[model samples]
Target: METILSATGLLTPGVEYGRVAPLADDADPVKAVGAVVPVQTHSLNVGVLTEPGQSFPDTDALITRLRGVAIGVRTADCIPVLLYAPDIEAVAAVHAGWRGTVGDIVGVTVSRLEAMGADAGRIMAHVGIGICGDCFEVGSELAVCFEDAGLGAFVLPGPFTDRLTGEPMDPDRRHIDLRCANVSRLLRRGIPEANISVAPECTRCSEIAPGPCAASVAGSGMTLAVGSEGKSAARSGVRLPSWRRDHGTTRRMLTWIRLREECPS
Candidate 1:
């Protein structure tokens, strides 16, 4: 059994490229090595934003041996995992939602990076923005699925009392910690403790909180839905523009990772 640990500020900003228009005049947002874009919205807008005539074409995870080429993975409630292998000087960004998790996409990505000569032990992992355990309530079947994946334990029949409160809690609402789960998975793969980092905030929980902070509750999920949804729905134009743009920005926001050969004892 591997002991899961969190990262402590070794990752740094490589670069940022907006997936949308008004290219920031700094670095062409289109050709950044690991750029994050909406999963939906098949538009010439994205094409135009990217470098001339260069199209990624239906890729959720992007990895590169090319330095200064930052890959990105867009997510709201889903897990955005960024991996870096210092030994090979390569990196990968993965989108692992419940569906992706069950598919073992994270493991597959690690394997892919290793195939490219990345040392698993030298890889640093970051499990970015998504729903937290306390905020994400799910069905028993789904809970079991996470357990099967080695991310969590099976929930048993009970009142599901709050561990902190020592009071009965709702049985129907069991919170799943997707970030911690992924951290466990990474540790199992031999990634060191000091190399992994997790965002302390939860989008869904923050959304439901009172006031201006609460105003953006639906933003994350909405953004992800737009990109992951098919062409018809995304192209329907019913979705808000901010959702589209924010999804693109979320791909560029905080959270980074760096793999180191010297382990901290």
Candidate 2:
């Protein structure tokens, strides 16, 4: 598993696992590794996040103030976000696919952390595995979300030709850089640039590509299918999958942003 390290200043460090699925129900969900294990096993004795006989709820994020509690997010293509606030010693793990991104869940989490007494600067954020801008092709309407989020410039003109196909990318087809968008959001929230880091890998482009590139196509297809069903279906159709879909990419990107107070002189 590829993991990113934290910059020296923040004491609460985290690792983002690329291409790894949360242990299936048959697997142990709570085995902590690295810094998270000691917290999970010794200090905070909590059950694994998954529940028996129920699909993990459509929860795209988890936050814990319990030291040694390891919070994990599973992603095939969607972005997994990990946040740590050294001052309060709290950590949050988030899953941001297009809907979550547009909903601005990351910013919401940041606000929640602040409400919990975490200084925005003392918080170190890591945006993990997901599809990249070039690899993600969506519609103009979808593209507007990023623009609305202030990352419009990252959108490139396309017929973003598919790496596998020479066909012109659809006009409705918009390529999204989930990581860049999130990083932009973090910076806009006043998180310093030097405090932020991004992974260079694209799940779609990696050997561990989460699923068939067509998974996005399938997801979009499903959205369209749901739209045909009814108004409610249409409204819900636009939402991103809460769990792993397709064989989506799994390469994790680990980067960090630290607050001024937490920064090392």
Candidate 3:
């Protein structure tokens, strides 16, 4: 069955957030939630929404202080980050692919939130599912981009084994941990370590439901062992979509966030 993995519980009381894997031809889930979603260009531009149903072109991040108006980003394998600042009653949804990460999109989002009367120390972040370092093999040029941006630690030496089939990649390929790179950005912006929650699933290897279809779609693979920073091991049998695994599949998982009209005491 189709499902949405919720992270609202990981955030403050007045926030709602989740990631949903839609069927190949399902309608837009953002519309179903009455939220605004940007037309992304894989750029660094962030849209600041002031009203319900607002959208912008070439936007990969979204921020809003409006109550009851949700914001979201669609991704196949890129990381989705949801942020909330209770003190300012503001929220942001960011889509950080490799290019966005190299450009420090999460850092840019946090700075924007801080400018809007938000305290970085009080902001809570939920880093959603994406391609894991083990599965994301890249060329040296892309790896150097992260290294030059001072995120070199998240980039690993290659001679990688495919996370799905355990086959060796080119010895010279490199892997980057997009999730931790963005987490480092959040920490650098002053959000406490305890204020962040990371989704441990790797979209490429996190299989769909168990069945003949799953058997056909997923291969025998080793599970990803996440870091010791309060993260769980990556599990299988969740229905999240992946552009890399599916080879340019149009299906996307929508990660969304909204502020509640009433805060619970």
* Predicted candidate 3 versus true structure: per-residue lDDT over 1-265, tens digit per residue: 1223343335456876665555544445565556689998889998899966565999999999888777889898899999998889889999999999989899899999888889999999988879999888888899889999999999987767887888887787889999999999999999999999887778887654432222222232211112222233335445457887888687777788887778667
lDDT of 1 at 208: 18
lDDT (Cα, tens digit) per residue for candidate 1, span 1-265: 0111222323444322111211122322223223434342211111112232244565555565544433454454666677767676666667666666666667777877777788898887767656656545678788878778665652334445443246666877656777777777677777888888775544443321111211232332211111221122222322221222244443322122222223323
Residue 185 of model 1 has an lDDT of: 69
Estimate every model's Cα lDDT from 0 to 1: 0.49, 0.50, 0.77
Q: What is the alpha-carbon lDDT of model 3 when measured against the actual structure?
A: 0.77
Off by over 4 Å in 1: 1-54, 154-170, 207-265
- On a 0 to 1 TM-score scale, where does candidate 1 land against the true structure? 0.58
- Lowest summed lDDT window (length 10), candidate 1: 222-231
Question: Looking at candidate 2, what is the lDDT of residue 96?
Answer: 70
Greater lDDT among 1 and 3 belongs to: 3
Question: Between the candidate structures 1 and 2, which one is better when assessed by TM-score?
Answer: 2
Using TM-score as the measure, name the better of candidate 1 and candidate 3: 3
When sorted by TM-score, best at the front, the candidate numbers are 3, 2, 1
